[model samples]
Target: MERLLVVLCPELLEEQEDGRAARTFAGVVEVVESFSPAAGAVRPGVCAVPTRGPSRYFGGDVRLAGLVRTALSRTDTALGRVEGHIGVADGLFVAVLAARAAGDEPVVVPAGASARFLAPWPVEALERPELADLLRRLGIRTLGAFAALPTRHVLGRLGTQGSVCHELARGMRSELPGYRLVPRPHPATAATGDGSAGAQVRQAGFWGEAAEAEARAERALGHLEQLLPPDGVAVGRLQGGRGPAERARLVPWGGRRLDPAGPGPEPWPGQLPAPAPASVLARVPASVVDGRGAELEVGPSGLPSAPPEQLSVRGGPWQPVTAWAGPWPVDERWWSRRKRRRRARMQLVTSCGMAYLVVREDAGWWVEGAYD
Candidate 1:
């Protein structure tokens, strides 16, 4: 069975100016990921998190919901304490509706009760104006009324989109015929990291002034320069840099950075291998780690064994470190609705003095990469 959590933040950007709203939402998504990786933005003020996996670790659904609420409450988005609703259910439609139905607390629908919980809600909750109009005309105002109609008849008249609506009304999976449904930012107007079309504050001309738009765009390039790692150099700089007008055309606010030499993201410094995704460990060890990555002790099973003794090494059959560097942290995917990642990377030199990249994530520690 699928499980979903809907976080409704009506005031997420109510206080911000044009550009700041998108940035604020990005920051908010980051906070959600600190609680679970299965979360993503549904819209500007709404986010959906799949909690089935993470909830088990935090006890049960109710307790996990409480923890999520606490996290959102403690999150200082600098936009103030915007309230959030946490709804856990079998489907996104009922889960979101349940969130809106809640007060200052969370709502958790039992495994198979989403359809029943959704039944009494009015057709308006579907948020489809045209379909609601049709349903009203037919005297089918509540979701239960709409769900009672034969699926074949609905499909014959309203087509695939109607099929989706019917499924939603019945609290079933919303997918079109012969197609796998892909998740989208709920309420389509929600801006992705790069901003939306016709609402391009950061991607296009700032504040929509055609005059000096090029100049503003040129200045954005300057901002991009500062964001890159010290070792990160534009490819254009290597092959005779292109003019500002050419660079200005690239979208700046998108999560993917632009390369002056080409259109794609600027290559990672020295083309370092990106972090490899791995299985979450069933058990995490307790260990003390600080910047410069020294005196780490781990058990044979690759778990942090214990706190390090000052100036003394705690040796085990596992990889013993001779030297180390970095607690270099990564906070990736903050710009999109699907926020992910909270981990620190450390380079360790084993007894053989061979270096390995290790990561510490919420799920536990794992060796990320190896130096050749």
Candidate 2:
């Protein structure tokens, strides 16, 4: 788990139509960057700095916190009366809670004391509603209680997600799911009045070997750009949606480069669980049938008429469905009679060892995508 110092400004969390919060938060990030060059915005009004280096330079975590708070106080009157809460802990998750618990002074959880510091927090602090509800029902209301449960039992009961949360409760993991946002360049290092080309020229390479590798990669990309048509070079950018296809878009390269390694889109209400499919295909016609070779269909209640037995893509020979999950219903634009849509999606694994995502509409089944 990486030790982090979280800076949260309650006043600048919510964005207004005028984007005042964003601008104010940018100023806050700038101030923190002055202390540590690695400070990054986790979200609007929430930023984190890796404390290892900065703590050493500033004499210690406590003194570092005090110095930051003093600096922020000096900027409050100039930058819309900002109230900053600082917390230093072993991980991002606990550090955020420490920040929230802070008052006028910074909260510093001792090194190697993350589990003890987190023991008293509610299981709800894990921010997983379904798991929290289950734990509450099982009389496991506190993080300590959840952590005490046998790992095998938790994994058996809740699967991978439960195991992950259990690790968090035990302080084995530092970050909460979705805590990271896409990395946006700091305003000071971003494109200046000179041009976007200046931004590209300012590559980040901490070592000589890495710098040489980056230069080689840049040269290769430059050659590729000259060889390929403008539309041939593209990259994927994430967007908000429930399905893999809807959540990503392919944009022409040489614009803003979005890091694929960054965190995914924020969780959507009806989104499929992760390990997203490896490929998203156009809606291709497919055939699905039950054991008796009867076509399967989804009813108005979104339940399948019969269990899926086999699938055939584009009239290909049927492959036996070895496993399947879901009739995850889609009811969009429900308030509007004319625009309302009703559909269901299912994951099917065939005997050929291939998995596919298929959707059922009023017309019939269509293959939406496939998994690796």
Candidate 3:
């Protein structure tokens, strides 16, 4: 589960008739956004930000929480003074509880301690009133007691909803039902022209349609970054190679900047034709045989001893080959003795209408890729 930092305002949880709570919370979100662009409003008076990157940048989780608390202190809101409670923990459910528990100092739950920290909490913390009542009647009044029930028995006796709660009790899932909300745009800041209290004036041309599109893209990316592990997101760059897997490589998406488009695919000698395979697979042992049920071989001259008539993958039943393409021989790094590779590749369509890219090295055959 991803570690999260939550900011909760008890006073602003419920909106007022004048909409002061929502506008105040939006200001709180803006303050949190200064620390991490991935910060998002979970509700009117609640917000969360993934702490992985920011914690490292600010030295540690304790320091990061302190900085966030200090920054939120200076934010002016319609409610006169903003009171933000900060907490850090793994997953959203426990993190929100941690925020509520915080007072003058931010609460930081140590890593890998979510289950232990949640064990003492009441079953009501799960927020399912029916489940909590049933568990209490069964003598399971605490999270630890509820989690101790056998998972299979829980599923069989209580059905899917109970199974979901079981996972939450065991600290397996990150969020509770309805914990995350799609953030709505702030009505005050989105207003323009009249120069109202929080109105943001917009200019034309470069800051018009293109700028709005870019801002939307950035927000989408920020939300994506929050869900993924630190540095987990990447973009693929195509390069010259013989096989589909080698023709492209994944590079980390750094600094939240998109690279300019590159030139399209270029012709390379011995490379496969256009319309590459849809999926690249690990080296799966396969069998390629002739009509006589004899294993086919690719001789030293890079020519097959006999035409392939059947193919079997991972010891599965053999499927008849309906159509086939050339044995494109690749002899790379020939100058280096240990680094050299000599292999033959062929594209074949099976009787089941599945297409595969199979390779032969020495006397062994393997399925390297598949076509949609």
Candidate 4:
């Protein structure tokens, strides 16, 4: 693979938005023979350019990086001091991380040493929060340990995502999975007379599991309601399931039918923005039934408070459940000596037919949320 140089603007967002980043990036592009934005933006905070042409024009990778930095320094002083870190490595993933670690100086990972270069970093550096959490629970603390895992086993548990992380740990070519919001094209490049040029679309996925993929799709759709213009609507099919064949039409979410009487807890006045509608509680107290079917009440301190009969929400009135599901167990972050969570969740319907997600963690059982 050709050595790729990654240029990262450490504080692009803090810089003036009136073309400062673009002008600086355009300067680098003028100097570098060939380059591409890693993502869709003209001046993405991070970009990769092949090092061959620039290295040959200058003395070497180090000299090429210095030249690019000098170009940026001269490009725009209106934005005040703008500095970038450059990393030269074999692949985009390592190159990006290397640039981040480079901090004002250019760092070059020797060709064929990308894997070794990445091995010492913590697995958390992978940046896929979910996959990192799973790895932590499995006792994989560092990239080297994760790289040592059998590929087949990682695939079986994490699916395509696991495979991607594994490849990164080994410093191989791999596509990062998950949703990415694409920015609109720069006005100078946008063509006239076509509404299509401004039409926006949000893309997400390539998830390994059907359920998780569907959940993410639903969350994405819910968010659109807030993102769209007042009179605008998004029209497209959510495509997933086994292959390209299975797809579902997008529709307004008519939330769960279970409407509880009166209102639940109102937001106690606060400056914090309301939590995202789909966020799950980090900790919740609940009435749990173990694998042996023994019922127990978990309290505010996350300790068993009483037998099943006395179980109730931490501070709410005792409401009887009409039906209940299993005590499905979940254990996460077990590798972290202090952050492990061993818990189980249950689906329950109250006497009024309202459903709730309740969880029992080491901290104790609590209600996660209402079904609706």
lDDT of 3 at 105: 89
TM-score, each model?
Answer: 0.46, 0.49, 0.54, 0.44
Model 3 lDDT on a 0 to 1 scale: 0.77
Give the per-residue lDDT digits (tens) of candidate 4, residues 1-372: 557787777555222336676565444444443333322222345556777766776788778777776766665444565677788887556776788789677888887787798888888787778888888899988889998987657644664456556866776642233322234554544545434323322211122133336446645654564576422333434333211112223332321111112233343221122221133443445555443445675443435443332336655666666676645555556699799766555556667666666766554667766655
In order, what is each prediction's RMSD in angstroms?
Answer: 22.9, 20.4, 13.1, 20.8
Report RMSD for candidate 1: 22.9
Query: Which lDDT values do the candidates have, in the order given?
Result: 0.57, 0.78, 0.77, 0.56
Which candidate leads the pack in TM-score?
A: 3
Q: Is candidate 1 or candidate 4 better by TM-score?
A: 1
**Better model by TM-score: candidate 1 vs candidate 2:** 2
Once model 4 is optimally superposed onto the true structure by TM-score, how far is the C-alpha of residue 123 displaced, in angstroms?
A: 2.4
Candidate 4: clashing pairs of residues: 284-365, 284-366, 285-365, 285-366, 286-365, 286-366, 302-363, 302-364
Candidate 4 Cα misplacement greater than 4 A, ranges:
14-43, 74-76, 174-372
User: Which parts of model 3 are misplaced by more than 4 Å?
Assistant: 180-372
In angstroms, give how far residue 233 of model 4 lies from its true place.
37
Q: Lowest-lDDT window of 10 residues in candidate 3? A: 198-207
Measured on C-alpha atoms, candidate 2 has an lDDT of 0.78
